[model samples]
Target chain A: MVAAPCCAADDCIIEARGLTKEFSGFVAVCNVDLRVRRGHIHALIGPNGAGKTTFFNLLTKFLAPTRGQILYRGEDITHAKPAEVARRGLVRSFQLSAVFPHLTALENVRIALQRTHPGTFHFWKREATLAVLNDRARELLELVDLGAFAAVVAVELPYGRKRALEIATTLAMDPQLMLLDEPTQGMGHEDVDRVTALIKQAAAQRTVLMVEHNMHVVSRIADTITVLQRGQIIASGSYAEVARNPLVMEAYMGAPDGELRGGH
Target chain B: MRAQPVLYSLAVLFALAVPLLGIYPVFMMQLLCFAMFACAYNLLLGFGRMLSFGHAAFFGFAAYATGWLVSAHGWGPGFAILAGVAAAALLGLVIGALAIRRQGIYFAMITLALAQLVYFVCLEAPFTGGENGLQGIPRGTLFWLLPLHSDVVMYYVVLATFVAVFALIRRVVHSPFGQVLKAIRDNEPRAISLGYEINRYKLLAFVLSATLAGLAGSLKALVFGFVTLADVQQSTSGDVVLMTLLGGTGTFFGPVLGAGIVVTLQQYLSDVVGGWVTAIIGATFVACVLAFRRGIVGELTLLASRARRTLRPARG
Candidate 1:
């Protein structure tokens, strides 16, 4: 195998160089180069079908890139399995809320933490052995403001709480770089604000690369913003700088004259 | 949940009383064997969400192995049964490694194809006796001391094995490993994102299920004193699937209940209706799929929960 060329600086937690994904004849993501610095809320924003999700998939190793490499802490992880990548402290949440529907909210988080304990593969061990993790799992649930609903089954929880549970489960993994795909996709204004604040709080000690359609959530929490148009990076900088770029405005609104709006 | 232990004790008492109640020991033993088989199958299909269409490959193969060891090689029943379980587990490892690469219908198809391959191998293999199968197998002494020649003795042994294996299955279902299996079953992609090596967990579940099924098959061979192509036939696979679905797929006691119903219908109805037992079973399975999609136990549990909810409206 050929060694990936090193391009990221020491502080860069993840770097994508010349990443391209082609499904059959059509290109989904094309030659995207990006870097996420440590402990920064980096948001990848774009209109529908602009390849933001595809790029995120490539970074998380959900989709193998056709061309180019992904480096985590300057180590090439382009061909790693999704679980292996996650085990290396790069966990991701889905566009849809992905809690185990039959499990309680606390049990859903406990599944993530169970791997850290012994006998995760021991069928002979009693499930009560996992009770040791309950305190810690409850702590994580409380972290996401789901403390009261810990005993509730995940499917019974309301829409936004399910997303909160997903985040809580993701947090249980203790990832260094968390990839969230549209954390606030379908929510009321109140839920969107709560999740936005939750995301900001989650990004306190880790790097977050998120694909967000909601510009308000992006403008509020995203420290750095990368805008994609037709699978190519149109602008990459602070949210204010990317919002002021004319190409991003044209991509969002189809008119080059207007400024990129933050709310809604 | 609090009523579970009492229910279990009553079930054990009933099983014990069945022999003293003048029911044929051999028939009850057969029911217990099939019940064990269904429980093992449930661990995969109900809990792991893996539909294996070729479980008879393990079931029939283990029976043949035990029959050959006891009749041809003069092996003790215990060693023969252990060897049979080992053979089935080995087959499970090979099949699971290949089949888990796909999902849904493809996975089921792969298992079916591999099981057909095993069936053909058994048919053509020299020691399997092809059409005649391994017949006139001895009941031989258990551990070369405790005689299994008596029907009543063998019945107790089978019941004990059934009870132990059932408890083991329950233990496996409630364990941390079982929790992970449930998570994988519920959502594979999310489990993957959570850093679970899901394929390994799935493969382990398959092998364990297969091993337990083999235990049932080996026990059945000892009870019948013969191993035939019928044990490994495609219809046997279908019968297990029908039994599991008729009882309940995911519930712990569902498969056992299903196996009991199917086995009883086969034993008693065969004498009355002859070959129409097959047609009756088929119709029952169809009715089960249509009327109670959750299977008997699953629907009952739902109703009981609903009843409790109605009774305790103040809690809400």
Candidate 2:
């Protein structure tokens, strides 16, 4: 492991330099340098095809970059495996609800918590040994207000509840940096509100970098917002600053005359 | 759910009494061996969600290894069988390493192709007796005391082996590691993001399955007093897959039940129909897939769970 460079601005927990991803001749994420500070809610908002997901994947090492380097806590992790990156605490909660459908909601959280437990390979021990994690799993379930549905299979969960379960499972990882990709992609108003609150609670103790289309959600919790259009960062600042930027407004509404709607 | 332990105990008692109850000892032994094989296969296909088409390589090669050792080297049956299991595990590591690089149908095809390679190797190998196979292999005494020369004695030994391995598998399926395998099977990307080395878990599950399958094969060799190329054939691989699907993929008893039904069907059908036996089995599989997609045991479990849910009042 290469030692991270000592810099005065060490609050930048994740730093990407010249990060680029290309598909054939088309560049999906072009020459992006991003620095996410510690313990802040950072939002990556963009119109469709803005490559927010691609950049997220690049940071999490789900997809290798065609060029550039990713440094986590100053350590170069551009070549780390997804699992390896997760092990180092930069975990990702995927779009389309990443919870295991067949497992019970409690089991889903317990499985995530099992990663921190020793003897994860102990196949001979009575399953009662794992009952010890039930309380913690239950706590996480209650944290997401799904405590009553602990026994319900994940697949049977309501859409909003499933996203909450996903966040609960993500929280069980106790990650230093959590990447949530479109956590509220297909939800009604009620679910969106519940999940937005859940994400805020989940982000309380960690750094969060989320890709969201709902400007309301981005404005509500984001300390910093980066607006991207056509694979390039058009504006990066406080939510108010980015929301007022003419370029960011043009990127969202397409023309000068259209009002910048909060929900998309 | 509360009655499960009693049901399992009753099942165990029934299995133990099979030899004493005047059931055909040889036939029962064969059933037990195949049931174990199905259970082993279930460990991968059912739990790990890995479909291997070349499982016969492990099953048949172990038989050959045990038969070669006991007949040629004069090793005791107990030690010879252990050697067979070891050989299968070694083969599993090699095959699993290559097979797991791909997913879904590709994994199945790789295993199938590799098993065919084992089949041809068996056909050409000197000690395996090629087409004739190794015959008249001794049913050496278990632990140098319990004479396996008698079919009744051998039946008990095979039954005991099956029970022990089955229990071990049950333990594995309920263990935390097993839970992780289920998580991986349900959603692999999420499992990886949870910091699981999924391929390692998959490889381990594959090896365990192969080792248990080897155990079944070695026992079959001892009971039948022969090791045949038929055991290593692609058809045998297909048979286990059929049995697993027929019984249930992920359920604990599905594979065993499926194996029992398939082996019984084959035994009876071949006597009268001979050439038509394969077609009949194929038809049965189609019926099962169409109507019982969850497999026999899986559907039964679902029914049982539903019954329990209905009978019990809702709780907070």
TM-score of chain A of each: 0.96, 0.94
Q: Report lDDT (Cα) of residue B210, candidate 1.
A: 96
lDDT (10s digit) by residue, model 2, range A1-264? 564453125577898889989999899999897888888899998888999999998998889999998889878898899999998999898878999999999999999999888877887877788899999999999999999999999999999999999989988988999999998888999999999998888878889999998878888889999887778788899987887788877877776554567766
RMSD of each: 1.8, 2.1
Please compute and give the TM-score of the first chain of candidate 2 against the native first chain. Answer: 0.94
Tell me the DockQ of each model, to 2 decimals.
0.86, 0.81
- What are the interface RMSDs of all the models? 0.6, 0.9
Top lDDT prediction, candidate number: 1
Off by over 4 Å in 2: A1-8, B310-316
Per-residue alpha-carbon lDDT of model 1 for B15-116, expressed as tens digits? 898878999999999999999999999999999999999999999999999999999999999999999999999999999999999999999999999999
Show pairs that collide, candidate 2: none
lDDT of 2: 0.90
Chain B alone: TM-score in each candidate? Answer: 0.98, 0.97
lDDT per residue for candidate 1 within A84-113, as digits (tens), equals 999999999999889999889999999999
In candidate 2, position B31 carries an lDDT of 95
Best by DockQ: 1
